[model samples]
Each structure stands twice: as structure tokens, then as C-alpha cells.
Target: MPGLDLPAAATWGRLTTFLAVYETGSVRAAADQLHVTPPAVSAAIAALDAALGTPLFGKSGRGIIPTDAGETFAGYVRKMLGLLAEAAGAVRDADRGRVRIGAVATASEYVLPPLMASFIDEHPHVELSLSVLPRDELFARARDHAVDLVLAGRPPRLSGLVTNARRPNRLVLVGRPGLKTDPLTATWLLTGLGSGTRDTALSLLTRLQASPPLLTLGTSGAVVAAACQGLGVTLVHEAAVRAQLDSGELVSYTVPGTPMDRPWQLCTTSEPTSATRLFLAHVCDPGRVGAAAFHTRHRPQG
Candidate 1:
């Protein structure tokens, strides 16, 4: 309520405009979505800045980008807007139950299916939707309230969100059978930019003093395929490439400092819906779903 003491109409307009700009990353795009002129959008943001007594956005390379303050404020605005939408929906149909979940490829392919099955069994009336996305995109979707909750790698620090660490994912360097272990000399296959696996791979390469990757694939599956064909070594969640590893199409190397233990997390808005809370409890409770089902599949044997 501290930030809500302003004139209601003006405050709502500016906040919504700010959120549109933040999500779209452009004044012109936000204007188009809001059905207003670009200049009008600029004016609204300027006025809002004046009211708040701090600059929220800064110019960056032919476009506007959020300042740290803007990013933080945008999170609050998103939560407020989401709560409003939920309130309206509840008024219309109080009994309606739904949840939208976004997940990274690792969790989506391995961890989510069984958990989702259990959730559906327990709460047959709840409507559920799951989106599989890369780590950065998953965080963006969660921040913008596009999904009620996101299950993925340990999320980066973002304002107005809560992260509940669930289980650990082990990352290993894998490649075609009989591949060399010298990372500096070996070609690297990696996921596209902004992927958590790609970040981890790069970090591992840096520690090993390796050169830049030779190829960047768009998905984990593609990386696995390329590795199987002797393209290059890749770092991936061990469970993701389990079948290939078992079939002898791929081999895992025990790189010093890996299998890196990256924790999986459940990220949600600071204020979660009742349905979202229920689903989180169901998934996070080890007695119900159990950590073994989530973490024990296809673990590498030394």
C-alpha cells in the first residue's frame, strides 16, 4: 500500500504503460500494444519518473531500457496487475481453478511429467498448462506473470519474486563414444546464448582454459544429437541425455569440478494464487512426490 497512495487513475495508467514498455523493451512496441502514439508513451513514462522522483529508464542503442529501479518497479506492477486479473476472474467464477507453469528443458523432459501426473491425480478439477522454455525465457515468463510458476535451474536474483530450491541437477561433459577429454583441444557443442547449460559449459571451459565453442545449437536435444555424431563435447544435465548414454551413443567424462550440482527451483510471484500455492506444496513435499523420483533417474555411475 505504500506505493499505492498516488492518484489512482494516473498511477494505474503510468504503471501499466511502464509494464508494457518493460515487457516489450521498446516505447514504440508498448505504444502499439496500448493503442497510443509513441510520443504519448514517452510522456507517460516521463511523468511517472517525475512523480517517483527517480529515472526509471535509460536510452540504450536506439531503444529504451529499464534501469535497475525500473526493473524492480516493473516486478511490483506485474504482481499488482496479475492480482487484479485474478480478482476479476474470481468474482466471475470463484470455483475456477487453474495454474500456468513454465519450465526449462531439463525439468520439462525429466522432472515435470511425473510431478504433473501426480498433481492431476490429486486435484482432478484444476486446470493446468505447462510451457517448456530455456532458462532466461522461463524467468522472463515468470516475471511477466505469463506463467504462475516456473520450475528451472537456480534462478537469478530478480525483484518481487520468490525462489524455492527443490532438487539438485548434475551437469556433466558428454560427447560421442571414445571422445577426447582435453577440453582445450576438443571442439565444443553448446546451446544458444542465454541458456543455463550454455553458461555452465562456458564457465567450465573457462576453468579448463579452453577456446570458445565451435558450434551453438538451439536446444539441448540438438546439442545431444550433434555430440552423438562426433561434433563436439557438450555440458548437459545428466538425466537429459540418459537414454543416449545408456545406449552407448554418448559417453560422460568425469571432468574435475563436475558433475556440477545445480539446484532446481520453483519460482513464483511474491504473491502467489491459492492454486499456485497448493501446487507448489504438492510438488515440494518429499513425502508426497519424493526426491528420489525427481533426482535419482539416470544418475551417473563412477
Candidate 2:
């Protein structure tokens, strides 16, 4: 049996080349990023295949498609690179006091700016890096120790993490200013595919069991845009549509007896780090309240 030399067994050059390719998905692009010639990138890949005893990429029309082994290896490579970057970030933070935060797009757009602004104003020396991702990515980044704090919806469950509930977000129905009230047959506007908004709309419709209504949009933005254009009624965040509602560009509707409340939560890994604690303090403060107050003030007096 040939003795395995671990150093030779793991192809570092090829791994670097592979990461560049996997990230950019183009050999030429990877070469450009690495400041190497295309032929050198190709050679590194070939060397990697020789060391691993497997073909990595299969040529397609113009670009290359990763083989199954390549696909699996790429996943690990991404993790490894992420870990390396995170370690470096941790070292840097120790020297220069910084906080890293991750958030889902909705939270980033609607929830974070004000709280983070206040945090920054108070602690300007604490550098901040906030990345916006989808839910899965947000949790994965938090789980992987890539970020110090995660601002997002409550995950179904938590492991190696703790969460604190923040101000809740209300999902409300919206329509153009002149929308007529016909409870029996109002054309319901809704969000597009693969969105939680769409899912919420579907659930509400199912619960309400109104006649299968029209499909007027393919995205949450589309739903709002269609509503603005007077196409149909749609569901949106009360805060997000506040300006339009106040300006008479849009109007809100209540679900009669059912209120849709989705709470936002801030999460941190177990053994809350100083950065996480500080961010949590800021986000959880009563002064950092969301637009719930706006909804309360505008709601018709009973």
C-alpha cells in the first residue's frame, strides 16, 4: 500500500483554483480573480483531479458543469473558505473592535436600519458589517459563526443559539385609494411565487375560504405595484405601505376577526458574545420600536 502524504494528498493550489472557479463558475473569471493565466488555472484543476483521482468539471455549451464529485467538494470548499474568513474576522475584531451582523432581506430593509443607526451613533468605534441574506442563508451564516448577530424571523427551532423576540410586524391587506368595498367579491391581490407573503395570502384565503380569487402578481413587489395601479387588493407590511396609505395612494383593510402578526426576533449563538449582547440591547430597547405605533395611531378609534 502506498503511504499517503497528507500534504500531497490535499491539493492546496487546486483547492484555491477550485474555489475561485466554484465561486465565479468560470475558469477565465477565476483566473482573472486570482491574477493568474487561464492555462495555469486549467493546470491547477488538472492537478487537483489527478490528486483526487476524479474528474471535476464536465464541459457544457460555453461554461463547464460540475460533476457530482465536484458539486459535493464545492460545498465543502465553500464552508472551508467561509470558516477561514470568519476566523480572520474574529482576529481582526479582537484588534479593532467590530461587530458582524446578518439579516434576512425583510429585516434588513424594514427593521435593521433604525436600530443599527442608533447603535452606530452611540458606539461609532465598533465597526459593523451587515450582510443581507434569505432565511436559510441567514441562519446558516449565524450557525457557522460567520456573523455575531442575526436579525430575522423566529426560526422554527434553535440549536446552539438563543433568541429574543422583538417588536412584531403586522401583515395587512392593501388596495389602491379608490378601491370599492365589496366584501362578497373583492378581487384579492396577492404575492408571487416562493414568497412567505404568497404563503400567508394563500393561508388566509384558505381560512377565509373565499372563492378562488384572481392571481394578480408573481412577487410581493408585484402585488404592491399592482395594488398601486388599481389592479387588485394585496397583502403587505403595514409599515411598508404606510406612506402610500397616508397619501391616499393606498388603503388598508382589516381581516375582520383575524389579525396577521409576524414577530421579528434577534438571535445569537449560545454564550452570547459581547457584540451580540450589545446589538440585542439596542434592538430590544423600547425606544427602537417598529411601526406598530403607526398602525395603532392610524387605526380607527373604536
Tens-digit lDDT string for candidate 1 (1-302): 22432354346677789888998999999999999999988988877776666778999999888998898887778777756655543343222567888888778878788888988898887778889878777777677766778888876477867775456667888888776557556788888877888888788778877675479888888988998989888888887888998999988876678778776778888877777777877876778788633331324434
- Candidate 1 lDDT score at position 112: 88
lDDT of 2 by residue, 123-171 (tens): 7766788897666566676766667677665552547766654555677
What is candidate 1's local distance difference test score? Answer: 0.77
> TM-score winner among the candidates?
2
Per-candidate TM-score against the hidden true structure: 0.68, 0.74
lDDT of each: 0.77, 0.68
Minimal lDDT window, size 10, model 1 = 292-301
